[model samples]
Target: MAGPWITEHEVSVVEDAMRNGWYEHAYDYCEKFQAEFAVYHDRQYGLMTPNCTTAIHLLLAGLGVGPGDEVILPECTWIASGAGVTYQGATPVFADIDPNHWCIDPESVEKLISPKTKAMIVVDLFGNMPDMDALQAVADKHGIFLIEDSAEALGSVYKGTRAGKFGIGSVFSFHRTKTLTCGEGGMLLLDDKELYERCSMLRDHGRRPGGPAYFNEEVTFKYMPFNVQAALAYAQFQRIDELVGKKQEQLNQYREKLSDIDDLQLNPEPEGGINGAWISAVVFGKSHNMSKHKAIEELEKLDIPARPFFYPLSSLPAYGEMIDEYKTRNSIAYDISERGINLPGAANLTGEQIDKVCDGIHRILT
Candidate 1:
């Protein structure tokens, strides 16, 4: 059988939910899922949304981050992080990342903060949490909001605190590829009761305190998820610990097999921190100058599926004019973007299959 990533259990649960009319109960499922997720993260509140992007927008909107305000984000992340700021009419000020961990550098972030800066959207890249201690100090000193984009770090920890619990508000993705799969869904976790209430109203089309159609209110975008997705998400959340354990096992196996290879550099986990290990990444050494296209082709030829890391947010046309100014000087993110590749990282791969995948990389690089 092919080495597919999704588990049989996940498939079964999703199918059962679909057959039981769970999708139609999206609103109820969302409420339940939100409560469960918040409890899991030890957060005060949680809101389930259609996707992570919308969750981000909702957070920014709730925070009142709009025109004339600047939001700091790492230049190395996916465009979606920057897009959320743009959607709210906030200027995105790109900052450099810590080359070793591939997360935003707190020192660099401090250099970029200006009078107009309103928030810092710190991303936990590749499941590695940013240096939260440093970032928290900066946000506190400046009186600015900190938003944790924990889309890739659902189970990751920094200084013994979970990812979602660190920021004023945080967003998590439950997409097909995450450690926990919900098909397509997201959640926003926050501690502030007022912010949570605002997010709920905004997500539900600006519904007032009363029931539907009883009171009129300002227009707001509808970004609620269907109950079916929430049902699946809730089910997945119940098994999160098991899923994370399998992912950790897989990561250990990959590290054991490939750590000694001279031409490849594996993703590094923070000291004394637990990473989600959602995706295992490898970067070609400087001597190889191996382009992502060539590396991907070699892996494909060996029946191993690998993908390049996301293009730098600065490289996209939507933010082209700001690229030159925002590109961090001498950051490894540039090199990582060109040479980094994501290995198959779903939770269901068998030990033998993982060996085959590693063996293919060893054969190509050695």
Candidate 2:
């Protein structure tokens, strides 16, 4: 009745882990989960962290990104993307996104690259993997590190390669809203062995040889997740295929059912990628004559949960002036942010519930 978003299987797994006192097995569970996730995405290594933000921070630090360095990111993504760069004392250069796919535009990325540009974080926003080949070319040309923030793209694939496998380092989130939910967890995947070793040491408090118990050998922070969370994450990973399959089916249903509405526009899968369908998004076309905020309010009144898209980082107070000079103004990223809305995309939503949500939008718009 409350329109639950979490799967019943996930709940059961967590409960069982708690009851059986198996939470202490988190380290072992996380190790296996990381290995499985790496193999699933065809990556060489995977390191689990507390959340995606921390994972991104680890990757940035591991790559030696620091003050005077710049990391390129889309202006339209969650603040965490930009915050990760800032956490490393590296300036985040906001780039506009592709109007069609809502992911960072490769051309825009190239134009923003400078001598200070040290890395680029290409996010697979809304489960859609961007043009990695094109982005990779830009990064390669500039000799900058590329970190794929696959937080919303756990199961997404581009050009026959998985999203997490594209860059030198990548991160994934297991938040409740993601396709894969561990309540609160994240992972860092990388190809370089030395980077992985450094990330592990950093996550564990920089514990070095001569340091005290559980202390770091190098300068690091305690970003590790307890074993309890790791057990739940491992159990969730076991059902990832099932969960992703259900979300994809739900996306197809939404696409078909909402097709008749002329004013509503649905996001399509990328040209050569398979989306995880992490969240189903729809935009009111120019003809809708309704603001995104109004639509969200109307949907909420009808008990159909819908949320407005993320605000561009350039508009935020903390980094507003800094990013304003990055060519993000008057960009497609701003346009998409204003127009987009995320519909309830939980795997547990039944067909009737989805129909109710669609009907609510139709009623408000038409």
Candidate 3:
């Protein structure tokens, strides 16, 4: 039942959009939101999309990734990260994640690259990041594009660079559960002008930009965000620090509560990096005999909400034809996923709730 923390600010802008956003002013909020969001990520351009999945589809299409092409991404991610590649008629090559960071492993990515590989989709999973420098080096060596799926790492930083600033293009989600939400929305951030312009065109059915009204030059997908959603997102964006800070605080509370649990590994804070703390997760040690299912069962009995960490993408039935040796190839992904559990990370989650959850974990493990 956790929800976004909203105030009169979001209500006011949404009302403004509903009342005055029309015709000539229809895109006012969208444009403003897009620009400011991109700048926040230190990118030169931003294109709003209906959702993160649509944004991924748009990025794949804009990059001309199609049949016969392949995209490498960590197996430990949401389905959208892999499903989007299939929409482009491209094959998704699943790689193992770094056990410590829970993001795409650069070494695994390097081993997966091939002549068919056109891009690498590095997901910042659960607000955690891998070694971006090593991944970037691999991409550069192979002459492939680095596309960041930063849907969960909005405020995460690595070596002083924002999560969305590492790749040729990055996509972020503003879903209801995210730190910054507009009910349902996403954005594409990038520094390349040509790719941005091309994606912009693709976002609106490939209408020739400024050539003519209703003139379509090529056939493509339309993933533009509506003004009302932009208004809500923009309102949330205005309080970005507040939203992100609350998540960090929530994570701190979890760390304090679970600090004594030696059998658990909480989200990491690497040197020179700041974890966005989107969803606080804990992975029980293999020797602890506490699987994700068992942990969730115990928490549910105590009326505590919990979620399982993502399953290995290759193990899903939808991807069975693509990779069959998921257990062997992605041992770390499969291993951690079984023991990892996503704790309640709602901005409004109370300390008492966190204490109760941590107590449940301690009781189960001890």
Candidate 4:
């Protein structure tokens, strides 16, 4: 796997956290990072978590989603999105994705809404935003909550608004593979003070802030994020623009290198929308003789790492009961997964390395 672009600043901040970040200073980095991240996204509050999955689960709990409820989500996403719903004893209803955008189709979402539907989680798949206006309209019409799973879209913008600024709340990932990461961490961003406060207390064993010491209001999950991790994340967060720019640069290089290939489609940059370009991905056209499986095999022989796009969640054994209809239910997602693959776009990768990858792909396709 390609590693994140780490610098001396991360090392220094972590060292400081290890030495001086204790007791009263334990959450210094976390507070600073959370506040800045929230401000950047125009959110009123932010809560740090061990990882994105936990953040999604906590967010769902905060929204009061539970047994017998159904949450709508796109079929093409990491299981983390669906698993969180199950944690709340809610059924995750999979929806199809837009052919070009690869995000949950608003129409598909509307079709699946039922009396059991409590909320919809829209994933900013591969750092690309779906039609938020339409999705929000659907949710508003149905009186169900809308949540944004922006794990891969930290820097993405839709209509001048950042990825995390939409819906009732949004969750982000700072995994090793993410654009801005501190090994493993996540953040919940939202504008609702009531929801934020509730999740905050619930995140720490249900101990209400400023309450009696060692007292608990209710039983809940603990998804605490430590100071050292926060320090590392804060350091990276300081260079957010630089990191996002480098990711975009990598994607730009790939786009230029593959400009002559009309049968390939890279991540989209719709008018007024800025793609985060977190993972440089491409989907081979149906007319292309190449398939993702073939591409991966050829790239492997050439020593290039090619990551496959996510399979429809319904096709996984864990959701086997829904697998039979997945192909017809989410045709665009199934088709895209078959042809799509993530390219090597590490921020620290050299131009020579990118050229090699492009050349290998060219030769394989030809």
Highest TM-score scorer? 4
Candidate 1, residues 1-366, lDDT tens digits: the string is: 112245566567567657764454536667788998998889999988888989999999999999999999987887777788899988998777776777888998999899999999999987878899999999999999999999988778877888888879999988877887677888899989998888888887788534678454768978888777887787778788887787778778888999777767676767878888777777788777687888899989999888887666776687864556655552555667788888888666779889999999888776
What's the lDDT for residue 36 in model 3?
A: 94
Scored by CA lDDT, what does every candidate get? 0.81, 0.80, 0.89, 0.92
Give the per-residue lDDT of model 2 (tens digit) for 1-366: 212245576577667556664545546667777898898888889888899999999889888899999999988888887687898888988888987778899998898889999999989887887888899989988899888998988678887788788889888988867777677889998888888887878888786423579544676777887566777777778888777787788888889888888866676777767988888888778788776788888888988888888777787787855545643453677667778898888767889998898789778876
Name model 2 segments beyond 4 Å from true. Answer: 1-26, 208-215, 321-330
How many residue pairs clash in all the candidates, one count each?
Answer: 3, 8, 0, 0
lDDT (Cα, tens digit) per residue for candidate 3, span 4-68 = 99999999999999999999999999999999999998899999999998998888999999999
Q: Any idea what lDDT model 2 has?
A: 0.80
Query: For residues 55-164, what per-residue lDDT tens digits would candidate 4 score against the true structure?
Result: 99999999999999999999999999878899999999999999898999999999999999999999998898999999999999999999999999978999999999
How well does candidate 4 score on lDDT at residue 197?
Answer: 89
Model 3 lDDT vs. the true structure? Answer: 0.89
Q: Regarding TM-score, does 1 or 4 come out ahead?
A: 4
User: How much RMSD separates candidate 4 from the native structure?
Assistant: 1.0
C-alpha root-mean-square deviation, each candidate? 2.7, 2.7, 1.2, 1.0
- The number of the candidate with the highest lDDT is 4
